[model samples]
Target: MSLDVVVVGAGAMGAATAWQAAKLGADVTLLDRGQVCGGTSAHGVGLVTRLLWEPPDIGLVAHSLDRFRELDETAGASFDYHDTGSLLIVGPEHEDEVQKVFRTWRAQAIDVRPVSPGDVAEIPGCADLELAKAEHAFFTEADGWCVTMDAVRAMVDEARSHGANVRPNTPVDRVRDGLVRLADGDELEAEAVVVAAGVRSRQLIEDGWRPPIDAFRAQAAVLGHEGNRSGPIVHDTPNRTYWRPEGSGQVMIGDGTDLSSHEPGLEPSVDEAFAHRVAERLRDRWPAADPIHEVRSWADLEAATPDARPLVGRVPDRERVYLCTGGNGFGFMRSPALGEGLAQRIVQKGSPVPLHGCEPSRFEEGYGTGFPMQEGFALD
Candidate 1:
């Protein structure tokens, strides 16, 4: 059956879009290259922090957070939805910049406040930590992590039950004339098509319209910290190593700067040297954490536009074709808002929130130059 809307890419945003669209009484079909939970969605750090620069974006992410709370209650399953909050440790040189972020959050009335070095130590997991040499730090009451894969699966299942057709292992080739052609040469026609294909959405449009959404590789080590007392997600700004408890007795570690680049569909290699460097950094920062044992890793191309924001809104010169790629380093946190904004455009013929800053047409109109290449890295 022909669908009213055909959504490409079934990651977090795609799944959320399909589920919400179906809930709004639209006949939707969601297509993913692999399984729904694969790709960037599953690989993300699952930080659900509402700290954002753009006010409109905060609304959408906050919406998703609200849904997450509701879904957790309804499903009676914990996606590890921890409100343990987030601590952004500041360096001496970067303290002012961090304050700028805090002031911005305050102006926006986000639930954020400054924490003294002493006060910061009182928070769960941060207690008794050495902060004498530290600069400044702030804590947000609105940040934590979630089990991304399970949430994506639950949303996909909910959409399917609402008569939305979702096909895993069905990667779409491209869209032509408002029709989406899958890898198997199968065609599905619809009045509107939403390109929520993550980093891959850039290549779906014609050549000149493509943005420089660079694809980069990033590897993380899920360390087993035998006696982690830290209650919140812990991050050290200077070293750029972030550690957070994964429940029970295990904690995960990833270097904020240990990201690499890759071509489309090419598997990523775990950098042993890079991993060792990260381990060394973590050891110095935490001091009491257990040694790294085994590691499990996967890779996918992550796309980011030049401006460090996502390319959302309609495709240029295409009737009813909307592009929702380019979440850059902020994809997972921004998925809820992106999905809602796209749905508003599709269902109501106009998005209440202005997407001018993130519209794909801006790239086409030369508002921002393109960094078109085989692949690039995210800037988060």
Candidate 2:
């Protein structure tokens, strides 16, 4: 039987898209050149939360959290879904702006509140920090992190149970005229195609039809700590750093938005300097904590668009071909909403969530350059 939909790239977005399409009764096939969740998803820190500054992002994350709960409950999956919450730490200089953002978030009905520096130490995992040096912090009760690989595996399993064909180590050379051409010269025709292939999505499309997406290298490191206290995910906006607990006495730290051009599909090398810098930052933030030691470090490529928003609609002038690239480094957190929205656009002719800002046609005129990394996370 002919397939109704063929999804390329079995990362978070593609896997979720395949599952949603198959659940809607479409014959779906999910193809990946490597193992599932073996791309950028594997490198992700798995910080899933709804505490975003932008209205659109807030809506997307809120939707994703709901879907995540439903999937965990009904799909019999364990994503290590935690509601340990998140803290947007800011210094005195950004107090006013953060307060404004906090009010806006509260107006949106998000369970967020502002915590003054005087009381910041009351939060667990934050007691060791130099609270007196900080100005304000926005705390959210519902935001937390999850294990990305576990979520991907669960979704793929559910998709397969729903009759979606999953093929790993199956590379597609290119896509044209509603046909997927394999590297080995085999061709498969489908009623529709969804491109969620991360940075490689550009290569699969015709030259002129490629979106303005580029690959950038990002790095993170895990560290060993002394205490077993699980702390809230903390974003030190002023320092351009973020860290979170990784189990009992372990933690992970990363440079915030340190992006550089990189070749697509190449394994990234860890920067020793960056790893050391992360360790130093941890010490600076919490002087009283046990000395941190680097456990391991990794690097990966994340897709970035001219605008920070993802492209999540039908490709302009491409018949039955859709693009869902440019995750902007938060693909795992936003995958559920993106996948469901894309599927709705294909099968139901409308999305349950608003995708106007993320429409692929936004780049028709010309792609913008230089998106400020700090804007998406409310650092600005």
User: Which candidate number has the best lDDT?
Assistant: 2
Error in Å for residue 110 of model 2:
0.9
**What are the TM-scores, per candidate, against the unseen true structure?**
0.88, 0.94
Error of 1 at 237 (Å): 2.3
Candidate 2: deviation at residue 278, Å? 1.0
Highest-scoring model, TM-score: 2
Model 1 misses residue 292 by how many Å?
4.7
Clash pairs detected, candidate 1? 124-231, 125-230, 125-231, 214-376, 215-376, 216-376, 217-260, 310-326
Per-residue lDDT of 227 in model 1: 70
Please state the error at residue 301 of candidate 2 in Å.
Answer: 0.3
